[model samples]
Target: MRQQNHKNTFLKTIPFTSIFVEALKQSSMWVSSNYIDGNSQFQGKLLLKVDSQWESVQLNLHPEKLYRKGVGSDDYTSYCQLQACFLKKFTHFDPTMPNYRYGIRLQFGQQLSHLLCENSDVFKKWFQFLRRFCIMDKFARKYKVLGKIKQCDPVFGQCLFSCVRVQDAEYHVVKVIDKNVITAGQKQNLYRELSNLRKLSQTQICYIVEVFEDEQSVYILYEYYLGIDLRTYIKESQIYQMAEQSSQGLDEKLVADILYGVLQAIQHMHSKGVFHRDIKMENLFIPEKKRLPFVVLGNFCYSETTDSTQYKKCGTPGFVAPEIFRSKNYTSKVDLFSLGIIFYLLVYGKLPFEGKDQEEILRSNEKCDIDFKFEKKICKKISISGMDLLKGLLNKEPIKRLSAAQALNHHWFIKMGTRNQRNQYLQVQRGKSLSTIIENSVDITQSYYQSNSQLYQSTKEDDKLDRVEKEFIKGSLYDKLLYFNSIQYQPSKIRRIQQST
Candidate 1:
């Protein structure tokens, strides 16, 4: 009796037709009859209401048939705020719409229908009420699983851990995309990434182990990596300690090995016609335990196939290529440019082109004035051949840049030491521990020279010295001069230099 009274109260609050309410009760499917199709311009469909000319359409709101629903824009930029408000009101409703005009897209199998209501307020109420009947009850019956929320961020949404019974055994590490707020474009991108991951056969790349989805969320089980991202690894390794003390940057051989692994993974992706537009240190993961040169590449949200021709600007600021800024169509070379930036960071412990802000960074990228010389001062141990490879990878002209295949064949990679040599270098790098040096000296001239030397080495390296001499020059002039002075001005070395000149 109390349940019937509650039902009556719900029916009174929602101004919907009895036939619609009966249909919902019968099928356990939700339909919002409160929304009167405001557009009189919609042709071909017969008007359901002669009194108001408001058209009504039958929609099957099943979990398997419904792809996604959103208002105003597919990207959900227009109705995001409105959707958020609706989500707050109706906790079960996963609002994927952008806050703009009142337009809703209902996709059922291959058929798609667009419904435009009067305003945002009406649309919000419509979606909020719809959630009551549109709950994933059928989905709950299909998959019996237990899970817990792992991480939740506003932008990326929640990362949940679930265990599924497969062949009488449980599989863990399943990613659950629950009622967390996310855009429709992001939802589509998730599906696209999953599809692409399924197509890939490479073991080096991160791939989905299993996939399961209900009406409310998506569950993706991916192969796990027991390590930190490259960005954090670089910080923890203290590769920049060389700036203050007599330490060294990352070894050239180790850098080569890492790049080699990255290139192989990229080669596999390219062969599959997929390009990872956003390649950065944050996306690359290195194992905590010694895995030699192997590094896992994750985050395929910004990746695209080679055949895709749309030229919208996307990617992180410093790593974004010049062509993307110019709004010109680009190819897989964009990934190469981004890879070059990562490679430069690995070698120099800093970006090749940097600015105070995003705009400045983009401007620097546009100019493409890479500072190869600065690398010499900070990283004195790097080989000339390595610098040449950096130049090839970082070339502004996409056509001129070395392809992944060509990069693999470069002299630097060709001369790369054996796996044992790389392992030994990694061990040495791990062993060297340096305390963080703070600049406490007040001497103006001494501090000025030190700061200028670091800056001048970074910004004016190419302008001050010729590339040919830079390649041959071993260590710094200070070290060479100290050796010469210790030898009491060796005439034989001076004669050899004069002969060479």
Candidate 2:
């Protein structure tokens, strides 16, 4: 099969997580079989189709998400975590009877459990999805799921995984969204965006490589790039610490470097008449391969052409342009306004505006009265030219705000950054810094959120906001342009699991 693993086996040493066992969002697709580990095998029904039901046991497996075969059974209170499963697909099969064609022998320590699936197609899916929880030596074998890149987003029913294409051994970030949860409109929007992204892939610096959909889900694959999102980068960097001390804004040079690449990316989109309504730090990816911070803009869920009119009130609250709130007729300048928010963060070491919750933040954003309570102190951190660029981009009036192209030509870029820094950013190359803050840091977002702990947990008033954002804002089909103030788009990269000491 073209969609098959190299050895048809996972390395025996790779450790697995219990994510699959814990996430019971979908059916278990398991049946207790008498043919399992010794006399402990209990009888149960596999949810095979009622029209052609067969008395057999079957299961879906993957290393990262180890399936507990006997979970949710009244008789079998204990969980059966699959340690190593020996899968044998019989060449011969029969639909008339339970003459098994697929054989799966699962081993859990000293405990052994065996399952037989009647359908060959279902059996293949079981083997494929249950492939690996870790990387492969040969660059994670293409089309093979190496491991989960991130947990499922509660509101959107989407998650990310790291997969590899076998032929070229290129790693990809697979965005899996459950088709059952989203609305038809959202699905169409997704398909249309994916199509647009494909056409732009050849020209754009970074974009989704391909998209695939089946009966249950949509998978959008992105080329694997090392580094973290700007949101996480800010929170984990010395910036957060400095902010706590009410320290000065970062170096104007670094701030300019961080924004240079992202601006060019937005400029390219705007030139093509596309407006990325969502330009928050979470949507901006900074590659860590070089000291110079290179940025990649992603997540076109809210992006639309200049002519297309929708999601007028759609965007992350604090970063959204004021024109978006004033009128639905906002132009591509909205993106430049959002970019201004990122600039404010890089300079001030915190968001430009803040409130107890989303409503307050949106109100603050609408006024476009940048909270310069500490403007005097902040003025010391950034140059007059730098502050001028920030104010220009963030201008509430779309007609007045600087365009992406203009922002590139702004004196701040020319004055604060070298000619090489300004031009070299368009292409992913060297430079130290924003080039933004790069770190081998802990899952800072994870630390912030322990119990459904949302990002930037220092603020408790945001609990209601987090719940609303995570639960889909009451009957909304599409995931809102979330205004949680602290919800970071957590993306994990493939790292070797260190051998336990």
Candidate 3:
């Protein structure tokens, strides 16, 4: 009977001889699971087929042995060893069984880095999880595994997680998407642009969401934050929540703090020659703790500038600047105008130029009438000075609107608290003295303008226009050239001038 059992075991192991040999030759087959505090219990396979599933084979994985992978040592043996662990799990299983699989579920206590670190197989598994959850389509939408949320408006988005372990490595999987559709190339381009921007900005305005393509659309994987946004902070009165009920809503000082951080972020982008065409309350994210909230500006589909513009006519209607609708030549000031609107919203829950119709709103923009009634009633409790600062930002004309930096210097902010001086903050890194910080910020702004000036100049060289020639032949080829060269690519002046004449 024992001999028959041995013969059966040998026959079964014959098909998986390579994996058995690999286990013998390699030593790092098992590793300690430190990422999650729980003991590394070998959870069996997730069934891929209707019934075939993984059977757990108890193997001890060592910590030092696992560290020997992409922190790179010539651990070809480790690779084989890891494979062997999977093979061993399937050793006793019947291949013909409807449920025969091999995969180990690595559970962790908490903390994201545990899943992201060191072990190559583990990292790859984690990345796979991200792809499956955050970037996969069939699972997120088709299955509706991640339900929808109203907060992700104009476009709704969703996310989920899956975990895996190979040796000492921990792996995590996350998925994300917009309710509307998107293409692969569009996803790639947008993700690349966002990745580049995240590295470029010194401030936390940009929050990077890891996105990849799956099927017809792209999926975005990100860390989940159960934090509040600046809008919520203002609305919920966080200060009041912390056993301080007397302090409700946003105060002048708090508003300044928020604006300072926002401006720094916008300034950082402008310096890069990339304009955030859409800047609004919903786009920004803030954590509940002491850490500052960063603006997560989105909807680059309609972004435009002197050198780059897409006439997609995108943006929230009320928040969009006047110039976008007017067909007038415009620049980064459009964003400033949007920022002004946000500033108004931050101070007063209602918009400054509300109207029953589009025509009425346009008229309001022309009149620049910012009523003080709300500010008088609500903001008086915060600071009259804060109200004035908001008024300065809520200027109707883009020209008259406060430049992001100038807004930082308003009397209300200056008196609120000791903030990093604008110039220092731009030039030096974070954690410097207030005055130095301000100077650093100014220098950074100056450097940005300088860099952008050079970039714009280069872009112009390829698509340069002879302004004089254009005006001279304003009715002919010259007009055509200017219109063609424009980012919007519309023959705007010719038709309008012709009609008027």
Candidate 4:
């Protein structure tokens, strides 16, 4: 009788042990739960299972009313939270209970429900697990509607881009902006961008493809381009030319073509009363497989309409115009100044004015101290017209700077060689190695930094002396007399005092 009783006890314990083991495995997979359904007044267990093609959740309790079947986990939105004090009061209030009450909130379109759990640890783990699935589900549903997210593109601010398919045959780029990070100011800027993009009609400019929003984020779809930005392309080309012992850095014709395209785009924007306040090489995209002289201008976050005159100081550090620094009203010529910088970069593969830091660089811009003589040394084959155009664009006075139309009609673009001539000029011959070119460029930059440093120090000393003189002039008569007396009697008085001591 004792042996039979022991056998019965052991057999009863086996089921509980198996259930615990199963729960542990489910938790490891990040989906274990029991919840009370207030609407049905029925308790149920929720289990999520993912396979090669489907992600489904099974609710153990049968309901009197069936809402829908074959619904994927992605269809429901999930949120986890601790039970509020009021909720506990309304429900089962257990003051002696050690564990906290938690719940998973679910939303399917307009429908809402909550799954109540008793354990805090389980709530946290389940919440995290469910939230990830929610995001995954969101993306999966988007794939069905907007095609699949193929790959990630360059990320800017709180926005990211992915290569996405729109139709079965068409691929485009989609910008994802998290609504959680959108501030009031940023929202205004986004509105401006949308307005500006809508007003643009130029083929050279990149326009918005589509705009949509979900609960958590906004999506701005863009037409995809099969190329890198001008900055990356130029840097890569320089590296390649250096490695290949090419006599030329880049084809001047190609450079002219890129400039022409950018100028046209700017002209188009300007014609519409839109000013691209921030224009840099990074904003210009060129084709990866060059069939023609194609370029597209993008990134309109800083762009503004001309009707708004009260402008804040905004732009990339080196590319910003001098008037912007003075807090003065600036015109579209600011873009011209930036264009000049780009022109200089394309020609010489270096910035006209650089410093150890941004402050010094701004000071250099204020002084309009640029080295135009370096062009001949850098590119001996470049024509006088090219240099002249560069000078016109880079002119310090915005009023005197060349407009986009003027630059387009400039002799440099008109007289630039044919494709064959450009190819001939770009042909590789005996030249400096990649290492040698980079070293030379570095040496020049370092020398410029050293010179700027010395000049800065001298200017600082002069300012110090000027300050001393101004202070002396502003001093009271008694203070002035005391200063002079100290200067006159300091050495002799010190000797006499020492002797007395």
Q: Which candidate is the best by TM-score?
A: 1
- Which ranges of candidate 1 are over 4 A from the true structure? 1-155, 160-172, 179-182, 242-248, 288-292, 375-378, 418-501
Candidate rank order under TM-score: 1, 2, 4, 3
- Model 1 per-residue lDDT tens digits across residues 24-126: 2332222223222221111211111223343543332221122122223232111110100111111111134232235444222222234444455756655
Assess each prediction's global lDDT (C-alpha) against the native.
0.53, 0.52, 0.43, 0.53
How many clashing pairs does model 2 include? 14
Candidate 4 global CA lDDT score: 0.53
Each candidate's TM vs. the true structure? Answer: 0.54, 0.53, 0.46, 0.52
For model 1 the TM-score comes to 0.54
Write candidate 3's Cα lDDT for 1-501 as tens digits.
Answer: 754674364333212122122223433333333242121212212222212333222122321112222122233122112211211111223436423222222211110011112234543443333332122112333222234332442332333343222332333233444424644544444443433343332445433334443333434433343355556655675543332333454455556677777777777666655566678776666743445534445434334433454444445656777666765465676677778777777655567777899867766764556665542223224443454455555555567556666665543454455365433332333333333332332112334334333212212222233344223222343343343336212234434543565
lDDT of 2 by residue, 1-501 (tens): 521342244223223322222222322333344332221222323332223343333332322223333434433322333312222232323455455556444432222344455576656655443332211122223378878755343235438787888777777788777756876666556644543453343222455654443445556677675367777776677565664466443555767777777777788777666777888877776665644366677777767777565555778988888877767777888888888888777765568778899999888888878753344333235654455567667766676666787677654464465447434442332232221211111111222124222222222322323354334222122232232112321111101111211
What overall lDDT, based on C-alpha atoms, would model 3 receive against the true structure? 0.43
Name model 3 segments beyond 4 Å from true.
Answer: 1-150, 156-203, 223-226, 232-250, 288-306, 309-312, 357-367, 372-375, 381-388, 409-412, 418-501
Q: Roughly what TM-score does model 3 have, to 2 decimal places?
A: 0.46
- For model 1, give the RMSD to the true fold: 19.8
Model 4 lDDT, residue 93, Cα: 22
Question: Could you tell me how far off, in angstroms, the CA of residue 230 lies in candidate 3 after the best superposition?
Answer: 3.9
